[model samples]
Target: MQVDALTLSKFQGAAEPNERLPMKVLGQDDFLQLLVEQMRNQDPLAPVQDTEFIAQMAQFTSLEQSRQMSDDMKLLRAQASFQQGVDLLNKEVTVQVGEEEPPITGTATELEMVDGEPKLLINGVFYALQDVIHVKAMDGSNESQSKE
Candidate 1:
């Protein structure tokens, strides 16, 4: 008996024509399942060598580690971005909203996460952290004078 490799088309067969298919990357579980199936269906007369099985197990372990590292890096990046946004709070900032439009300058009032990315609220508008061009501490004297 021969086993066929899994493909994305197999998963999309029941979907509507107009619907979009999500891209799926095979992870550790999928890899382990394939390895188990291969072992179960191997020829009795020509059994797989011990070294080959060991090699496959090693490969699976490496794949799992790589996936974990990727997840950790993504989390680290998000935290760093959020920290940068927090540091900007209550500070005056200059941001470029568009190429043709003039830069907007305002005090960073709030920090929010939009679509899993950090955004800084300024003058009732949300701007991405990357768009910020300059940052300065608000003057204490000016704030006190304005209160009167």
Candidate 2:
């Protein structure tokens, strides 16, 4: 989510090394470079264990899989939210457009398609699903409020 060009540029400098996360994507080449650096700087007597390297690779794989799953879940959640909003049409809505409090007396009308997306149309005005602040039933009951 965070990309910095200056941080990436510093990676090309041999005199200074980055002390934080590198802005550029770390690929196989970067991994090989890091491995070489670690081998050169490792203790001469006590070296890194093979198990440690295997464990690190396993951890990296797990982290990548988790990130992919998290991204998929986010997309699914967004789709579900959109579907829920679209389904709210025909349900009375009470939204404050400009503070006039006119209440735009009308039942949930058909959803209008704009730019390939559905939007709720109430009282001849099309409103985005995200803009609907409140929904009221047409039965005129104060306690019949439902949250979408």
Candidate 3:
């Protein structure tokens, strides 16, 4: 019996009865399940040696570390974006509303969550952080001049 990657992934993360997960990703439980499945389906004549199993365990640890790093990166990126939005408060900004439109200048009066993206409120108009190409102090200085 040959197990494909898609089949193995689907079979690994299934929850037992009385278990509930609003969001489920492959974790230690799934890793152990995969290991068990590997052991179960191995040839009886040439069973996996202890050293190979240990290597698989080490690989699982590496997988876990990679997942943690990925999650950390996502958190760092979100923090940076929110900090950028927060930095814009009460500061003069040059916002590019459209590809063809000229850059509009105004004080960022507020920041709001729209479509899960940070938007800057400039003189009653909302501009996406992605659209704002430049940021500077309100006083024409190069540093963040005010938090208010």
Candidate 4:
């Protein structure tokens, strides 16, 4: 196949005025497309080896698995945070609202998710889980209390 100037320009990252720019990150589909293009453009006399192709496929699979693991980890963390907030319900907690303001001590009345993060309702006010400095069990038993 004879390569034309227009086709060469496309490979050179040249785009038309109205065309959208290429994505910053190459997705699985993009990787497959590039692989196919490489195979199509390779010289028939010296084609890509089977081992090389297999290696590429392995790399692609690894990338996909890593992405899935990352998503799963995020979900796990979110669920754990939510569980922590739920456990605090009806339990007295000391929350530092701000640097200058005094810490407020109140029972965690409700648990809510604000912007995908767990928030505890204490003294009719919603505060992030990080703001809670200390927690005290209502049953007079000393439980896990975070102080700092």
Q: Specify the highest-lDDT model's number.
A: 4
Q: Tens digit of lDDT per residue, candidate 4, span 3-119?
A: 885678778987774777667888999999999999999999999998999999999999999999999999999999999999999998999978999999899999999889999
lDDT per residue (tens digit) for residues 1-148 in model 2: 4547666666766334445755566655666687778878989899998787788678767877887899999778667766866666667776555555644545667776565455677788886665566666556554344432
Per-model C-alpha lDDT, please?
A: 0.82, 0.66, 0.81, 0.90
* Least accurate 10 contiguous residues by lDDT in model 2: 139-148
Which digits, one per residue and each the tens of the lDDT, describe model 1 over residues 26-90? 77777879989999999999999989989988988888899899999999999999998998899
Off by over 4 Å in 1: 1-23, 140-148
Candidate rank order under lDDT: 4, 1, 3, 2
Task: Identify the superior model by lDDT, candidate 2 or candidate 4.
Answer: 4
Clashes of 1: 0
The parts of candidate 2 lying over 4 Å away from their true place are: 1-47, 97-130, 136-148
Candidate 4's C-alpha runs over 4 A off are 1-22
Candidate 1 to truth, TM: 0.77
